[model samples]
Target: MRGSPAGASFSAAAYLADVFKLKLADLHEGLVEADIKEWLVAEGDEVGEFEDLCFVMTDKASTEISSPVDGKVLKIYHPEGSTAKVGEVLVDIETDGPVAGSEAEAAPAAEPESAPEPAAAAAPAGGAGGEYDEQMITNAAGKSRRVPATPAVRGLARKHKIDLSQVAGNGKDGRVLKGDILKFIESGGAEGGLAPAAPQAPAGGAARAPAAVVPGESRTEKVAPVTKAMIRVMEEANAIPHFGYSDEITLNSLIETRLRLKPVAEAQGIKLTMMPLFIKAASMALTEYPILNSSLSGDKSEITYHGSHNICVAMDTPDGLTVPSIKSVEQLSILDIAAELNRLQELGAAGRLSRGDLEGGTFSLSNVGNIGGTYLSPVIIPGQVAIGAIGALRTLPRFDAEGNVIPAKVINVSWSGDHRIIDGATMARFSNVWKNYLENPDTMILNLK
Candidate 1:
């Protein structure tokens, strides 16, 4: 049987010879359900145990599956997008020799008294301290830990394509956690080595590295690559169905209410914003029409309702738009909401928002109106059922009950709902409730109880 290489895929024959007692002939097959990110080895190539065979796509992300043994590639069960479920053959490897039983007779047997040694132990390795040491460290820590960080941390580093080992660890047992990794990543890691050293000066008291000069070259231009998050967000937005709705809201009284609350907010060192007011109004509306605060299942089997009102606030960043949610907005007062929103917005702009900030939002609000837009039909975020777009406030003439034309501060509020879950009447009711709350801002502030 062939020996499997570390980080490469192998056949069942290789597993039996190097790692396990079971033969390739005994194992079942499976199919590939999604696109492969990349193949670890080419076709007709030999693979060893524990090598990454290929990466398969899941709904949220892609995962790499390893080979169980070392063997030659005989067949690939399915092309990309083919359904791979239980008991399906994936790839077949040419076995070195015949096993003890016929193919048809190979069935379930009694459990062995002891499990076989891991195939990684027998594979030839490569790297800094020899392949064996790398394998030992990798296997002992598991791929993620051995890789020295979480996918998020690694992705952040990779956005800059920075190395993890070069960063100092500040986590448990000197292990690198997300925060430590991020700090190092943001600072571009160590200067010359793992530890800081005394500064050295050049002959003429210069401390900077000598700049290189290219003959006849005038200038150099550098371009940064896009981040994975940015790619995923754009793809998801483009691929998903996004519907929008807009309504003009009279914010004259809402603005007045903020003025009244200003003194109190200032006393508490909290700057007031319209966001918390919107959040309050939206939360009230969602309580009356719960379906608007839900998510559609991919299969459309059912709408998942959320008990908490985690309102996602869309903020503009240098990279792109990011929505960091204020969890349980229903439980927060106007002042509390304002403070939290301020902190979240700051963290978001700084590119320091945690994963928790970016996920599990029951609803979202995008206030492009702050930037001078009168109205916009905000796109419904994929996986989320609804998103509201708040537009700029403008003084528009309106007719009163007595037919008198009066100037009113009108703000456009657009609610984009998932057609799969919310109906026209439901959406209209939600909007009306929200509009009522905003127009009567006194009700929200006075009725905080």
Candidate 2:
């Protein structure tokens, strides 16, 4: 019943539940999503408190989620190979008794045999008063935060002009039940009683993203063969130790250089583009910072500094995301690189790339510029040391040394590197070199000749 008491009258011996959700492990701090590798325990399997239940794959790494109670798994909301947002329910463990020293308050004593069907793990889409009615919101920081409560509870809340997130939950796992909302309104809410948005931080650290509370819905989809392959590759890449850095670089000189060369290259029936320019500059920087063009062994015991700069460019194709590298970028001139890129892009668009086109990549570049993205954290392919995300190039007004406001073509580049070997300063130094060549292509042009 919507807005009903915590434990409504039901048959005795009803089994209560302790829900376990996929959350960010200590090792995975910035990750917001993960995929269910597989369910270790199948539905109907009995489990103990704090027991390993399933493996989840994240961009950061893979980890196992443990059960929080001693009970039989009553339901499995999410199946294998499905993506789940952080804080989404992974499993529901039904227990005859309360969890060992659980912090969650029991919804009064109910009929033990009347074991209510586990509350739908997620809010139904637009089902106001359905089995699982909840309203979802994405905060200013672009994160989906779900507020858990039934329709009537939410209506009562709106009538009193209350923000549900501010109200504390007294039901199972601190869920804000209808009664909790009424109690909050009865306590003179909004007058002096709204909880702040940002959760309190530790004694000496910056506040972390608020712990997600709502269990997100999990939908299953049949992936194509290419998508399956891509998923496997991406999951393998997820184990890499990733660290991100971003910088705004001016592209005025590069833009001018390209404008002059565009006609020269077009005369030969070749379409010169900015991507080849990025690859060229990145290759130059990789020559000096060889680690950026290197690969680590499976155990990370050794690093192989590749001499041939095979710069792979990530592209989205109808089949899936494909990365085709231009072989020996260091040996090719910018024009030659551009022609190769054009060939690969056409092949990608036509879905005709060969295995060779997708292999032997030492480094990667992702251009979100075409899509008008200012910056992105591009995923580094497994084995490669680094990948850079190219932002949209824009002419923004910037103040000069003389305090004169002048228009400057700027681009934001975001780099993610293997933190285990390439430290932040090293990545920053390499980025600075790459940015130098792009910002002043004349220096790179001298090397080309």
Relative to the true structure, how large is the alpha-carbon lDDT of every model?
0.55, 0.62
Off by over 4 Å in 1: 1-230, 238-240, 446-449
Please write out the lDDT profile of model 1 over residues 134-155, one tens digit for every residue: 1212333243223323233443
TM-score of 1: 0.51
TM-score for each model: 0.51, 0.51
Candidate 2 lDDT over residue span 320-390, tens digit each: 56677888988887777776665566445434444456778999998867666886888888879899998
Lowest lDDT sum, 10 consecutive residues, model 2, at 114-123
